[model samples]
Target chain A: MEGEEQRDGSRGGEAVNGSDSPASLDGIEAILNYEFRDKRLLEEAFTDASYSPENCSSFERLEYVGDSVLNFLITREQYFSNPNLSPGSLTRLRAANVDTEKLARVAITHGFHRYLRHNKADLHQKIEEFGRSIEEYPLHSNGMIKAPKVLADIVESTIGAVFADSNSIDIVWKIFKELMEPLITLKTMKKHPMTELTEMCQKRNLKLEFRDRWQETKEIEVLIEKQLVGKGSYRKKLIAQNRAAKNALDNLDAFFPQFNQPCQPM
Target chain B: MEGEEQRDGSRGGEAVNGSDSPASLDGIEAILNYEFRDKRLLEEAFTDASYSPENCSSFERLEYVGDSVLNFLITREQYFSNPNLSPGSLTRLRAANVDTEKLARVAITHGFHRYLRHNKADLHQKIEEFGRSIEEYPLHSNGMIKAPKVLADIVESTIGAVFADSNSIDIVWKIFKELMEPLITLKTMKKHPMTELTEMCQKRNLKLEFRDRWQETKEIEVLIEKQLVGKGSYRKKLIAQNRAAKNALDNLDAFFPQFNQPCQPM
Candidate 1:
């Protein structure tokens, strides 16, 4: 395992080297319109462990800092913006904004994935597949899809790199806030499909059950009133359940023809 | 439920009127030596939902914001202090500092618990019990003890209060940096007992198992080579497991009298 590179990280196109070239790094700075005091931080932000040896891998650390920074930015922003919101609501809202899907979308939006340095060979295919998949649900799939975590990591790593270099949160937020387009505000915020489906079923007094077929078939079916409302398949059980919930929510009209108003698209 | 008060949150002494008084609030400011620009934010920081009606509860919201801020502060601090540390180690170290037990200890040390305004009737007894329990472990108990969450909440809420009032993380950190005594550094940080025990047992080729009897009697036992070496009882299964690990570690001499230098003090 140590002798072989993972080669499983992806770039946007078929471009190779997956290494941080100076020109690409400069282009990244140009796009963000923020110059790093230490260029090494920016390079580290885009670097992947598979591309380098064990001792010099820094993106994970940067991503760690970035995750906290991003969370803080969103939390602080949302707290003042929504004064009357409860902590429960605030938590859900923050999660929506900074969750893997949202940040991964940010990376794709800003072409951050193009700058990532990695050895993952199949990553290109995964990134493209994710890009195509997300077009179906513009805002968020609400856990219906399992995003490539690397996409989100790069966004956080960049945020971390900027925050570390400037040592100013205001600057970091100023740069990324605009980049994270169509921010999920309270108006745009939507409940997770599982939460929506559960509440909807409970209100209608329907016999709701998530039948687990994952072990045998990697599928989960949402049963409502003894009727198979929706089914989804995934390698992970939770994801399968979430997809099943989303499928059930989307197909609510099949169960209640008169009450055909499915969950509104955010 | 709406008609009656909770009367559950506690003050340090057996004081009545779980409502916030101006003098007590003033005392809080004096304790921190940092005045709030907006006194309402300070009030909100200490205010619990039970103290007021649903419309006016703000401490939870503040706590929400403060939590992210605290996380960001610690992550940033640790990132710089330990340049060579991996993200995995950094995560653990950050968790050690910001965990419920550590922050609760901070609250107890700084007397922040006294200013908490709530309706908890049994809180006084709980706080007193917690105060006495921590005497056994000076720095941290590492999940051996389950600290009252409200104590930790107040610390984060106050940290949030200061950050919100001053709008400067610098001031919040300056005030709280000293209050959070003996910050858990890489030098003092210890692994969770469950993790430690598993690793130690694995290295020594000891067939170790955590037998769960929590559903029956809230007990967990560590069985090594089919011998009951250590057992712990707690309301929470995870805590019981952790306690059992600690117990097993403590009784290493009993297990193996030959090589008996147990886990050292922090």
Candidate 2:
């Protein structure tokens, strides 16, 4: 686990010395548009504990700080931008922006994953699968997809590193605000499929039930008024449940022909 | 609920026009040692939703902002102060400082509750009970006592109002760092009684169990090695459980003579 070249240096600019070349670090810096005063902060931000437990510090502490900073920044922005937004709405909006899937999307979209230093055997495959899964949901999968938390951790840790180095939140905001483009606004934010479906059913006084076949077949079926409206299957029960809800939402018109208005796509 | 005097004036200095006088506001400002740029923010911070709902705004929005600001401020302080602290420890420290019981203690210590404008019928009685209950536990009850959440919310809202007024976190910290005195450090922080009891039992290879009679009698009994060692009863089942755990910790020496070390009092 320890090598002379890997363990001897300051662990700064490890991006250049590790498996990736110097160009990889440069590419990430280009994406961030901010040069690190202490490149070790950057290295620490991207280094996972599984990578080199003895040589490199993990991103957990930075991620912790970054989580708070991002939450406050988003709260401040939305609080002022939407003066009429209630606390509940503000909370939902902030969650949409900073939740695991959203931050993971940010990391993947900017190719920050390419710069992450990790030795976990399955991370590459997980990232590849996440990349493929996200193509189905352009913005957020809500609870349907399980995003690798490491991706979000790196994004937060990077934010934390910038805030730590500059000691100026304004600079951090200026750099990340654009990179986190197309920020999920109230207009674009979608409720989770399960919530939407449940609420719709309740509003219409319709009985809704979910049949759990996940124990045997990894499948979940949604029933409305004793009619089989939707079925979904996935490796994870939660994902299957969410997918079933989404399927029910999509086929709502078919199930209830009297109300033919198409439910908006999530 | 509307009156001529309440409806005519700007809700800015309602603290003076409403139940309390200008002197009360002045006294609060003196306690805070920081005058608000907009007195309305101060008024808004203290106004509960139950008070003058038609004419005056509540502190919910400010509380929301303040909650975020406080979380960030504590995170930043702990992150910088304890360079080697793990994220888990940092989180626990932050939580110890900002949790409802801790913040409520701050409010009670400073007599901030005296100026809260609310129509809560039982608030006065609740505050009195909290005041009396806290006398037994000087630092924190750690889930043993039920602290009124409103007391904590007002403290946070005041922090938010100050931050919003000055648009400076430094000023808010300068004013609050002392008011929130005797901040619970790692040395002073106490684990929840239940957690302590469980850990002790597990360490000693002792079988510990909680017999819940809370539904019928509002009581919880702790048994070790099938011997009833401790029992507690409270109106709240959770509080009863915690007290039971505390009782078990207190009687550990009597139950096991080999280990005579007195358990640390929370």
Candidate 3:
């Protein structure tokens, strides 16, 4: 496995710009504000499977480990800090921070993607689009927008690399704590639009429906009282449904004038 | 929150047998081989929602935290130890160790369930059944048997309680590392019967089907070549399916005798 990993590293290092070099790895270390003891781990973390399809480094495996580490860190942080939070709320809070979009935002914020050695053609475009979309929802879109998984994978893989090299979760937390800025607190976290709408409908004893027109128009139409209350569009059906729910929620005051809805959705 | 927790502790402490008393908590500590700073946390860990539903303790929250902690421990342990494993294999390996059945088995192995302060009548019966069923598959059933969730909950809640009280994952790991004996290593772990059968069918270019007679008979029938290859019964449909697959896989040698299957379907 070590021999194969080294071979993968050398093969991936021989890319167009030699991006997996020692100096290039140092840039990643600079971004993370932490150095690696096992330089190969860092290289492996940044080496996307797209870079070398045949003998790829353990990028996915590192992402897997990093995901579990991040989950543990976030769960521990939330469990202690928010002692009154129910398990359901804690789960959501942790998910908001560790999710693909949130981590992708982190990568963009720290320019972590610039160091990612991937030949994925649309990755940069997707990252740019995600960066632009996040401006509309400062904290999280809550499934309202499509987030390129590669951006998040790089973040997790790097996190995995850091944990693997340091072999200290505290060190990983210290470095990533700030990098993951404005950690989605319970105060900032909002219920996913669909969930809120469903609860509202349940409370009012009203029938709520989302008509999936995704095949035809890549949109989800929120229907209440057999009326098209809201419409939202996205390539992904779930995101489109969330967007539709958000649109309906925004128009609820005028649409359902008699309902006593909470003034602040949060 | 601390005030409420104290109140909950006292309320739950006044149970039928005083199982949540100081002495009982000490027994738990002895089981864990670790004492707690805030004894309330230990009490909360054992207090099931069924014990006093109106204003129960934070057992679920602790379970949530413990689940994440256990996940991280197993992931880190396996990631470094099994460097050759793919992310998929690593996931299955970790899941085999930390899943409800495995955790429930832990609770029963060391008599951890005796301390769980619950008025749930069927809980003991289910635990006994799970204990007996596990004797067949000593390591893990892989969804072959029904392991009562409450049993798993106590294990996780206790783990959470220990972590929260000690404020150290290492301490929790040290205590749990031994309790979770025969930690499902890659060597001992086996794939779910359903998954194995599906892979086998896909490899052999043979279409496979599972007829869910669960509603009528509480059983799943595995049909191959329009022949009833095997059948398995369980209350849970998925477990029934797994059992059916195990039955099918067990009989494949004598039934078909031509698939060139692995000698030991480990």
Instruction: Report iRMS values in order.
Output: 0.5, 0.4, 0.4
Local error of candidate 2 at residue B234 (angstroms): 2.0
Give each model's whole-structure lDDT: 0.80, 0.82, 0.81
Q: Write the per-residue lDDT of candidate 3 for residues A1-266, one digit (tens) a residue.
A: 22443333422232222233223566676666676888989888888887875576848999999999999999998998998989988988898999988998887677666667777776666777777788888788888888888879989999899999988999999999988988999788888899999998887877899998888888889999888899998877788889899999888878898677554443
Tell me the tens digit of each residue's lDDT in model 1 across B27-105.
6776687767788888888887778856556588788888999999999999999998999999999999999999988
Model 1, stretches more than 4 Å misplaced?
Answer: A1-23, A53-55, A211-219, A233-243, A258-266, B1-23, B53-58, B211-220, B233-240, B258-266
Q: What lDDT score goes with residue B160 in model 3?
A: 90
Off by over 4 Å in 2: A1-26, A260-266, B1-23, B215-217, B260-266
Instruction: Tell me model 2's lDDT, rounded to 2 decimals.
Output: 0.82
Model 3: DockQ score: 0.81
DockQ of 1: 0.78
List DockQ, one per candidate, in order: 0.78, 0.82, 0.81
Worst 10 residues of 2 chain A by lDDT: A8-17
- Tens digits of per-residue lDDT for model 2, A16-73: 1223321245456667778889888888898888777567898999999999999989
Tell me the deviation in Å of residue B106 in model 3: 0.8
| TM-score of candidate 1 chain A against the true chain A | 0.84
Chain B alone, candidate 2, TM-score of 0.87
